[model samples]
Target: MLARLATLCPAPILQRVDRLIEPLRATCSTKVKAGSVKQEFEKQDELKRSAMRAVAALLPIPEVGKSPIMANFTSQIRSNPELAGLFKRIKKDSASAPSTDSVELS
Candidate 1:
């Protein structure tokens, strides 16, 4: 009955139930020992920590805008007289391209 109850309950509630039943279980020949229960809890904690570390390692680091190298290169281009003028001309040409909003209807 306690085993079934443990399955239905959340971790915190299940832990409390385990604590409540510990003395009764200790007296029962068929029940698990307190040391075994403590070992199981430690194993579960280690598994959770390992899973969290794996997830953190798999995720990419986030930063605002372009990467450092690209950002530095763009800044350099904008600061140079010849490159800055060329970049402005290209930007203006791209901006002047026809937009879907201005499409003619037949």
Candidate 2:
């Protein structure tokens, strides 16, 4: 089962799997003492929960961008100090004095 799971897991995650599971392998091995069995089971349970959460995140949400939702987010973001600074920067750039080159004749 572990071999098959290791095969299916993505490489980046699998790369560190041994480091995580190896130390506990002696206790978790069916042939060995059961001292690390609890740790191994907990690890498997955590992996399952994490996978479920990832799958849930991938599910689509309908009405994800209703106008009221967007308006609320926009208002909240607009209230931010950084947003205010950005707005000031934009306003200052637009309202700067026109240069001689800007008034060039067509």
Candidate of highest TM-score: 1
lDDT of 1 by residue, 46-105 (tens): 543333222122111222112343234335544656445544444444355422112111
The 0-to-1 C-alpha lDDT of every candidate, in the order given, reads: 0.35, 0.35
Model 2: per-residue lDDT, tens digit, 31-74? Answer: 32367687776776455333322212211122222334333433
Question: Looking at model 2, which ten-residue stretch has the lowest summed lDDT?
Answer: 97-106
Predicted structure 2: clash tally? 0
Name the TM-score of candidate 1.
Answer: 0.31
